[model samples]
Target: MSAIVSHRLHLPGTSPVHRVPAEVKIVCAVVAVFAVVATPREMFWPFAVYAAGVIVAWRSARIGLRWIAPRLLIELPFVVLAILLPFAAGEPRTTVLGLSLSTTGLYAAWGIIAKGTIGVAISLTVAATTSIRELPGGLSRLHVPAMIVVIVVLMLRYVDVIADEAARMRLARISRGDDPRTIRQIGATARGVGNLFLRSYERGERVHLAMLSRGFTGVITEYGAEPATPRQWVLGIVPAVAAICVCACALVVR
Candidate 1:
């Protein structure tokens, strides 16, 4: 199984953030994301403070930046697209390194950078500190669609399996001396993808039949009743409260 899948699952620990209720952490993450989204891009200071808030979570949860770094490659392209938006947006601002930029473009880029970074940070915090079982249930309670949760759950479960299958296929190709460097090999690569998809589809059907024979009423939901501790209450809401304070200060100062 992938480290991420295991990592998201609550690892027993004494960390403050980890000790917080899964639901509270999820809520905080959501609220923080919204705050990042709502704040104007030019308000760079808030983002700096917001990044501090993330740092606090990272420290509290005991999740290192190293764990979060690799996953960020998944985000780099979107970040690149966000950077490009400044050129495509409203009026041009001064050039950075000889590239003409615009206020609209600059703010656009800032918005993307801020929001995307915050969102990703929040999500990584949740994944790092919370367990898979508690995490999805938290989302379900927050009124996220049960179907979406189910899909996410199944997707997580199967991702590594699919990845391993793909790896095996790649290795087999490499062993066959199939150097896919030329455009001519692109068709073969597409066929490999198509083949992988078909195999996955067939396997899914088999899994579904096996599940049905056992019984699957669709959405899976199960959790214990040990309710979040008062300790969690303090730990969970602290960052959110600090965020509220930042917003309040921003309003008062402006």
Candidate 2:
């Protein structure tokens, strides 16, 4: 399946990172997230540096801005909230840049904005590049409980089917000139959703029964992951080192 619903997840290149083990991508994302979070909360420069680091890694991994940027919308709410944090704190403080804002609160807001944005971008980049199929195997290899993987696998496989069914039903309504933009249409839409949910529930039961009849195991085995090659290491190290250096600089500056 394509990434971002229909977008191609894999970049077209022979970069070594394209062949890296799935587990490594997961680890890199997690470690990078931690790096962003672990930086001191009082500085902004480190976070900018952190963003640069992730971008560098993305470039090295052969992932383009277009490939990775679609997911930035996910971070918009968080960033907006983070930007408001300083004003919300209500501590008596000095104004910065002609705005009556608290000092520590401003710093706090900056901390969240910078770190949170970096974290989301890094996470999205990993998601953009990594294959969905590899995720199950990576999780299984990393000692994640097999049941968890099983549930994830089931949900991913079925959710799209359920969604298409919902869309088809919606199209049927639209063809009948069911105007959905009014408050009066809300009930109809709710009913449509409820109907879809019921259908999905029944389908899930039938699938489970079929699986049982076929002697399905609770845990599906991963075909297994190839080793994380050196290319992956290089791709990882650029960002990791950049993030660490930026954090160090922030710590020193603070």
Candidate 3:
């Protein structure tokens, strides 16, 4: 499980960024994102500063652009929506390269793209530096609800299991000459999905039973996580502080 989590997102590194306590990194990432969201959409310079901060973080974490760039494709749906905004939005339009675009929509699109990109970038950077095992402890340290933390941890732990199960199911179907790509096989595909869900539910019940047999308690005990020191907090929070300052300046200038 540790190997899977490490390979999926956490880049193994000994840099200062990776060395910071997970709780500190979590707080910093959240604060920086909040600062970005608070900034006015009309202002563009602040986002550049935010991007620069993310770049510095990436550099510190020794995460290359090649590693992070592909992950940013997760925001493609938002980008598509943003692209349509200028065309579909209401009046107050301006001509751009022979196309009439909504002024408000343009700003909205820019806000979506800039904020989404920066948020995703920051998230990837944090993920690259912090392993999945560290997340529950970090959230717990941050005073998040215990149940919510448990749910997140369990979900992360079992996602790969569910994915592997789905893959195996697909292979079985293909081996039986079931071509899911055909429109005629849509019903079969739906049935396959339902079967997978049932299997997953049964598996979950068995796992829960096993846990109870092993004296499972409601509380999840975190191991190997040390408390963050003041120095670590200060160093980790510098980027977030910079973001907040930029947000404030953007608001003032606006």
Q: Pick the candidate with the highest lDDT.
A: 3
By lDDT, highest first, what's the ranking? 3, 1, 2
Query: If both were scored by TM-score, which would come out higher, candidate 1 or candidate 2?
Result: 1
Expressed as tens digits, the lDDT of each residue in 63-151 for candidate 1 is: 77777777756779888998788688766577888888877878777788777887888887777777666756776766888888878
Instruction: Arrange candidates by TM-score, descending.
Output: 3, 1, 2
lDDT of 1: 0.75
**Model 2: how far residue 215 lies from native, Å:** 3.8
Residue 170's lDDT in candidate 1: 81
Q: What lDDT would each prediction earn against the true structure?
A: 0.75, 0.72, 0.90
Q: Give me candidate 1's TM-score against the actual structure.
A: 0.85
Candidate 2 per-residue lDDT, tens place, 70-156, comes to 756667787788778777777678877888887777778777777777787777666556666677788787788988988976775
lDDT (Cα) of model 3: 0.90
Q: List candidate 2 segments past 4 Å from native.
A: 1-13, 93-99, 102-105, 229-238, 241-245
Query: When superposed on Cα atoms, how far off is each prediction in RMSD?
Result: 2.8, 3.4, 1.5
What tens digits encode model 3's per-residue C-alpha lDDT throughout 91-173?
Answer: 99999999999999999999999999999999989889988778877888999999898788777778778888999999999
